[model samples]
Target: MKATDPSQPRERALLVQVVLGRRDRREAEDSLAELERLADSAGAATIGCITQRRDRPTPGLFVGEGKLVDIQLACREGKANVVIFDNELSAVQVNNLDLALGIKVIDRTEVILQIFARRARSAEAKVQVELAQLQYLISRIPVSRKQQRFQGGIGMRGPGESPLQLRNAPMRRRISDLKRRLDRIGKRHASVRKRRPWPLVSLVGYTNAGKSTLLNACTQAGAYVDDRLFATLDTKTRLVHVPENRKLLLTDTVGFIRHLPHGLVASFRSTLDVARESDLLLLIADAADPGIATQIDVVHETLAEIEAEAVPYMIVLNKSDAATQDQLDHLLAIHHDAVVVSARKGEGLDKLKARIVEELLAHDVHFPGENDHG
Candidate 1:
């Protein structure tokens, strides 16, 4: 099959499946909706979503054989060209699914990597994404090395390069080279931050969590706010007026997702530097979502992975108009500093801005501009 030719017809339609292990059906549905968002981000028109509830995935196929057959039938009926799994699939799983379904198969990790690959604008971002893709490809190398011998340098290797020649030793060297280049970029960013005396506030949370909406609400930064996941792939900083018209830089950053590939986290580290260096972080949670807690945990873990957890942050529960009282109460108990707001309706926005000012002042009270109200 050469791993490139398609046994099935290729088109735009996609069949997305959400894999739930020990999570409630409601949560699974919420996560499935997120997968649809990812598909939309990747330019796939989602036809249907299938959720498989299992305590554990099948060894070879992500879902049980019966479920796989059912999904295959659905794909055939829908004439879908792409099948996206909510979980990260092993290389063998991807190959097995491609063989069984005879269609292009992509897991959540691949979907995210695709977004990073597309949204990366700067050289640093590009390098980070390539490094992450290489790391991911390194892990997912098929067991059939003979078949993959032809696929050499298809993923991890640079333009027209072959991995067979360098083998493991040279591959490690390239990884090290990428790290050193990223370090230089990081140091330059540190120098820029040191020059700015104004406090920095960062927006962080699950992808499509309306962090961009809030950023626009407060700063009128006009950050790209599409309904799709990872819409704001690159972080953009704009000066925002807090309480009393006080100004501070607000950075809208990349959103996090559950089970995000480690390669992605590593590659986006430079982009996520804005979040790590912020004086205050607004961890936005989609209040309208049923799986808000799980999404929050994903963001927290990602922050920890980037060593950004030490930065003081408050929860911004977005989409409050679509949220129920129970959901709001449940989240409020855990995040006392959290504020529920609908960025779409402009409701609770004043309070959210006030909280941002309070948090910023708690750390340091310095008027960057002419006003001095100490």
Candidate 2:
């Protein structure tokens, strides 16, 4: 509600979750906790949280009328200016909720899209994020255009300087044009890959699991790294040099997350396709996260969804410096074959590199000398 700066006001958000059948209270809490992190990543301060048990989502509102009233009271009492839903909401549902709550209402997918829109730096990533954003907004346009609209921040931020909401006809044209442009970009990337004479290896992991940090540690690629979720959206390939002058191409890719939207998966396939093409994948994970196993499972599920399951992968537990000895041991004991490293502190990287060399050699590709990857 406070806005000294119109373009970048601090959002005070109320987190909401609906517990459907079969998902217990703990699971719902875990999800809400994750959503809170997402809100924080989008530069919002969480002011309150509300959860409701529902047999099924009410047709127009995700929550029951009583629960909706409860939420209204919470929003006023807690002074929340925004509401972020853990579950995906229909466009109509979002519209109705916005009217009822008297604030911005966005679902999980929109939050993820907002992060992608802001994090995208390269031309390719920008294109992918834009196309995805357009696809998402095309459906929400009719509902949004009818409303008196809350402006600027989170779901409102997107590619370029243009206004986000556009006419359906023009927006469809934009989506098609973006798809074609992305297709060309994907083909160009493929052509470049064909020209490169080294084995391809990509780093895949949950968001903010230190893939870029590992990349910088290994190849000194100086990739952009941030502590927030979805920090690096661009695909960066750098040549990793091992002993005896043998080298392989290493790529840092966008990180995966639990419940990553299906639309995002389709839209960013051009970027994610790198993992599918790789001879080997370094499945990175944060050693400190108690949810490390679940995060690893999500990455594996995403890889399978992208048809990258056939590719051989090694689990690399990174950020060992942040993890307690007990945590590290717990992970290592569970993942006996896993490589441990602190990409930020430059610890255990040599051993990780040695494993990489072994894995790449197993694929049996001859490396050419002194070529810096792009």
Alpha-carbon TM-score of each model against the true structure: 0.81, 0.87
Residues 1-374 of candidate 2 have per-residue lDDT tens digits of 77577445388888889889888776577678888888888878898888888789998989999989988998899888889999889988998999988889999999999988878888988989888888888766544442434334558655643344443568778888989998999999988988888888899999989999999999889998988888888899998887767778999999898889877898899999999998889999999988888889999999999999999999999999999999988888989999999998999988987888787767664457533351
Question: Model 1 Cα RMSD, Å?
Answer: 6.9
The models' CA-based lDDT, in order, is 0.80, 0.86
Off by over 4 Å in 2: 1-9, 141-167, 369-374
Instruction: Write out the backbone clash pairs for model 2.
Output: none
- Candidate 1 TM-score over all chains jointly: 0.81
- Report per-prediction Cα RMSD to one decimal: 6.9, 7.9
Which candidate comes out best when scored by lDDT? Answer: 2
How far out, in Å, is residue 184 in model 2? 0.4
The ten-residue window of minimal lDDT in model 1 covers 5-14
